[model samples]
Target: MSPPYDLVCFDLDGTLVQGTVFIWQTLHDFFGTDGDRRRKAKDDFHAGRISYRQWFEHDLELLGEAGATRDLMLAAIAGVRPTPGGHQTLAVLREAGLGLAIISGSIDLVLHRHYGQVSFEEVLINHLSFDHRGALVGGTPTDFDVDRKGAGLLEIARRQQVDPKRVAFVGDNYNDVSAARAAGLAIAFNPRSEELVETADVVVEGDDLRGILPHLLDE
Candidate 1:
């Protein structure tokens, strides 16, 4: 049978991987930045005191000050790992002829370093600026950063020339709720909250990513 969906998009941190708030942790772990400033900025952003761009810029500046370097980030990512079934699921999707992509708030460089082996046709992620010497200089936040995941999904649909109704999104956290709503099918993988489960059309809980395939393929 033909693929049920033309595109399947996934969130990076905590969805395709094993953790959340990865960017913050990477900055702290590698650069020795306490991240207290970022915590305050995040609170302010959440409280509507700052725009997402502002919150992101403030943290980028902090990271730059802490001397975040490419070498340091690479060192930090060395200990990270993918979701248990992440690679397997990607292969299954590709074999079935479904286009795959990743839309995430996490840094792109980090994702590439860790998941470079995975085959994804499109990747929409935040970019970090680096100096000629490869030291961190700044960052660029995408729609994923401002709780605009739905918008990201729509943009993907537009680019792929596929109806939004022909897309499925799999995600884990409350942050993914809007994106799920935007897609034709919403699969909550290893759901993080009651709200996420309630919002999803299908919920798959467990460490194995392959568990999600039955619901998806059976469609």
Candidate 2:
């Protein structure tokens, strides 16, 4: 069977990486675990109060105090091995000629590890600024991506020169659900929250993202 869509967009954490967001895990290592905040975010996510962007942006801001640099974030992400089937599943999608995109709320340094590994043709993540000498100043990113996730998907489709109707997006958060639903088809993978699961055309409960494979094809 042919693939159901021409493009595939994926969220990094929970969707592909699974469990903790890379940055947060590092922060927890540095500052010690704060289960209260985690519970609060999860509760809010389930209660339809805050978005994945808000939860992530808040967590990042909390971690900003740790004085983590672009280098440190990269190191942390390297520690976060992708879910069991992430890379293989990605290879399958790329082989199918699907325009791949990584539309994530995470920092650029963390997502950059995906280069030459995951099938994403282009990635859109929060960028960090540094001096000419390459030291992280720990300031806010000039162009935050949360507000632009959906537009990023559209931009990818435009750049790939594929019809918007031919694109599919998958994720596990409410923020991603909006953009995913806007795509030709949306697959929610092992969603921690119900809002996003409800938005998806297909919801896979298994941690193995490869479960998403069948949904991508038109038998």
Model 2 Cα lDDT, one tens digit per residue, 159-217:
99988778888888766765765678888887766877777788888768789888886
**RMSD list, candidates in order:** 1.9, 4.6
Model 2 C-alpha RMSD vs. true structure (Å) is 4.6
Best-fitting candidate, measured by TM-score?
1
lDDT by residue for model 1 (10-82), tens: 9887778775445566666676765677688878998999987887788777777877788877676666668
Query: For every model shown, what is its TM-score relative to the native structure?
Result: 0.91, 0.74
Instruction: Provide the global lDDT of candidate 2 against the true structure.
Output: 0.69
Model 1 alpha-carbon drift over 4 Å, by segment: 19-21
Q: Which residue runs does candidate 2 get wrong by more than 4 Å?
A: 21-29, 32-65, 74-79, 114-119, 129-134, 138-147
